[model samples]
Target: MATELTAPPGVRVDAPAIQRRTVRLLFVTQIISGIGVTIGISVGALLARSIAGTAVSGLTQAASVVGGALLAVPVTRVMTAYGRRPGLVLGYLAGAVGGLFVVLAAVRGWVPLLFAGMLLFGGSTTANLQARYTAVDLADPARRARQLGLIVWATTVGSVAAPNFAAAADATTRRAGLPEYAGPFGFSAAAFVLAAVLLFVLLRPDPLLTARRFAAPTGAPDAAVARTPQAGAPVGADAQLPVGADAELPVGADAELPVGADAEAGGPGPARRAGLLDGLRAVRSRPDARLGVTAVAIGHVAMVAVMTMTPVRIGESHAEADVLRLVGLVLSLHIAGMYALSPVIGWLTDRTGRRPVILGAVMVLLAACAVAGTAGHHTPRLAVGLALLGLGWSGTMVAGSTLLSESVPVDLRPAAQGLSDLIMGLAGASAGAASGFVVQFAGYPVLTALAAVAVVPLLALALRPVPAGAAGAR
Candidate 1:
């Protein structure tokens, strides 16, 4: 399988083998970046409370999510023009810089700066999300989900270790004599920087470009025609198709896209840089693409709404020490479920069909909501529920992401992916903003009920018939 992917025409290198190496490199980089992202996310609320005081602490996460959503535009634009390496490297670097600013905010007791930094700090989140797409870029179509899953699974290692860094973070604070929360952010900054360096140095040949080469058929005369624009280029009018509620099916169900179909046409389309609106417009034109984007966005909304509040529910009853330990254990299991078992989900997506996996995710989310909604102070019930919630999220993530990548043509891929993440971040932010009120007013069950209900649209969308011509439509 590895050797079969020898260079096509102009290229003489082993693209598949290089892709494998890139995956491995990204895997290791994600471990470090994952830790960086987790440390910031874990401590953001606490730091907000410490600086801004408890009154507005809740908005810290919302700000971070918003920042991440907004950054997807510029980040993907860069990727569309340059390549994954530049976009990813820039994201981590921005996050690393954000960490430093947060440290400054802590020192000056500036709450606004703290939010600003946390917002920029969300670049790590963007990088992490984008990295999943990169994993599938040069991947074998049949094995696409599996490759993405492995990267997702790799993050579990660092995430599970992140909370433990509180001690280390504290130690750094003492040694540096900075704010109590400053140490972890400092450590996160370093991780982000290192990740950037690795991507710059090691992610050679650019997987997306390599995949384009592989996508061209063996002997078609005009196989090298360009379908999508390169990172910054525009699509041609003739190659364009309208996408929306009136969306057309791709080519055929799960069809192996011709090189030009997804942007490997070798010829450029329009002359402008792609942006968020462009991405949304592209996905909207294709039915299957719309489903993929919808699934990812709604799935994220469901997960964040409940997961963000679970700790608060536990903190409501448990002692400080018990709450810390219990939350750690529960969150660990949840994060693990989100990633550790992803390979199996990917395999299932490949084997059972994307729609089944999506429906399964919805079912799991429903079950998670049912258990978590009423569990309240009960330990076992809540733990299992949170874990299931993570699994459910993973199911949607893997399947939906794969579908999104495959359904769209390459020129649109970056923008489409960026749009997917932007919507997802916004959805998560909305959920985070609303969860607190819902829980405080109507109770945790109400919050879970809302989360469950949020997925109804996704479920309905998935149930719609996929067009036979759409690649991976089912």
Candidate 2:
């Protein structure tokens, strides 16, 4: 017989077990999303370059960045009202729609339509990026960063294969009788639909809801607690009670709350605070959160600024196949650097500190700029430079996100993440927009120098003296 949870009607059972299941489901979901996203990425800029002038190719991804940034608040708001499931599903669906638009644009040779498709396609990237947050929604504070990083690392499984699959996608063009680049978007659309379906069917007993019920302390189960003398309970495990009796948490939170919240006010506690303005105040109220957001936003600007123009730079000299192959190789390496070592990055965030990692990211980005800027057209050196860019981006991203999540109250976290991601999106969008103009006028070397300069604020902040109760704590 199913053990009836003796806790209040709303309370849930087996949170740790449920969280594990949630992570597994999310991992599968992320792999599919990774494939969908990278497939589009492999072709997106290149297609835009062909359809429009190279000057505007950067605008393709830039438009997507803007779209994703714009959706942040709305997506998070949906999560707040319903749950992570609905929000993620919506994001993927939007991406699917965007993919169709891209195909339409390619078929018609319409620049506007391609930009439109890419902008909405940004939703896929948004979903891919946000998947990491789901893993830690019910994570223990001590192990939160590690778990988040592990989920990010999972994306590497599908993402690594994505660029290589460009050939497969190209072959798909022959079968589908579509434009060459549109083949990848066709693949992208199908993958997003499959991912959405899997999540809808399998992500049962949502983890965030269950976690809230467990955290709420006020209500009692209908039945009385049966004091059964069972085998010794594990330390910090739920108190031993009747088999069906509701289990209560200790006086305070021993581990991290889902999404960095402490605990939901189950009883007559403070009502949930939401909305754009409230989120801004919540962030501004906390010094650590402010700094964390700044780090994340600046890191994104540097990464995107350098990354957006890379295909254009190398493709100027190579044949179509060579350009795609080399760009694919370089991109795969850069993306690999972004997520492959996140488990270590997460562990180090816990072991060392956020500030140190932030500082390290600055140094790596500086090195990447130097290598790529001076290499002229050396493919090997450029590849290495891009990979370092990914590595440096990974460090700041994981560490900065962990710190931001940890610093905020649980109830306010959705809004906080929305706010931070919005800022990140805007920064990336701005850098991307300026990137083409810079490469056109000042040259790629100056563009790289600009990216290097973008790291200044982050480095300066990291080097500042941290006070007690700083956001650096694991």
Candidate 3:
């Protein structure tokens, strides 16, 4: 009976060839898509400031958040039905169209239309966010977090180049007598179109589909097929079945073993089908998840609120050219901070526990906020604060994402992640717009103070102990 039993799900499962190919293709496509996304985001606020002026700059940031929130469900449904390839292709197409509209808006100097275009263009970011899940679609549970982290790190290449691309676009616009932001949007459109083509043409058999196929039962015998004990059997043979033909077990009546007879007697267990509600329940039940989510959500709110306004504030104080360069530098540093530490963060989560990293991130962000508040328009202080903010964001995001990954089963991962991202986007948008109003009406110091205050509860939650059962799961 021990030989007839199927191997444990994770112990012997091998990734399908198609799944490997899909991961490679998606990695390439995502890198290109990242470039397009970076271009759009790098230039978006500048475009808004140029066209809509200081009063409605927040609307640009708000458009992206609203688009992400609105499209989260639909995007998840697309990935569910058509698979990741088509969903990604369609998303890039939408982004291309949106980029065109942005260019037109810039050429015509239409603020509302530009905002609309930004909303549309920003929908692609939703697709980009989903890209990490695609990387882990067929990965083993032990390697899933690492695979996700690798894909995220891949985006660093594009993100690092994005500011330079935006700068080039800005220069091109001046030389061509076009609107200041037209070149970036045009370049972004081309990049999206290219990525869409690559995804449609190269991503074959889809990683998600491959995972589903591998998980299905083959209708083989239910009894464990135990191998003949050789002259030398490993000591752990009692605990684990031998690989291949070594552990053939008897069939029929001989296979009938007493229940709970041996630790390794059972065949592969049923696959876990975690649904959306299941993920939510996991989050609700896990104190660690709750604290991690709170830290991420609040930290994101503060980060976006301050980051969104930095360029505009700098522009108000310095020349447009100098301010744009400064904005580009800050954004580059921010992206570096966001993605560069993901692998290390994942390792830390696996080793040191999620709470310490999360709490430390919140403390760093609090310090950043305080620094930003007291900088009194000092560029160096602002730069330092922004860099720290990026570091804090990285820690929180990696820890939060790792926590979320563990909470949901493979099936529900995409939807649950979408929901989490959607909520983050909503909070970020609201805070960003409110920060603008606060900065305009009150001052940057007041805005930063409010963000610092919001971090307090997150810190408390991060420090709280998990229940005994919950701790066991971690």
Best-fitting candidate, scored by lDDT? 1
- Kindly report which residue stretches of model 1 are placed more than 4 angstroms away from their true locations once superposed: 1-10, 213-272
Model 2: lDDT of residue 218: 32
lDDT of 2 by residue, 200-244 (tens): 666655444333333322311101111232322111112232213
Q: After superposition, how far is residue 209 of candidate 1 from its true place, in Å?
A: 2.5
The candidate maximizing TM-score is 1
- Cα displacement (Å) at residue 152, model 2: 1.7
> How many residue pairs clash per model?
24, 5, 17
Which 10-residue span in candidate 2 carries the lowest summed lDDT?
217-226
Clashing residue pairs for model 2: 6-246, 7-246, 137-258, 141-256, 261-410
Our model 1 lands, by Cα RMSD against the true structure, at 8.9
Model 2 vs truth, CA RMSD: 7.1
Clashes of 1: 24
* Each prediction's TM-score versus the true structure: 0.85, 0.81, 0.75
Winner on TM-score (2 vs 3)? 2
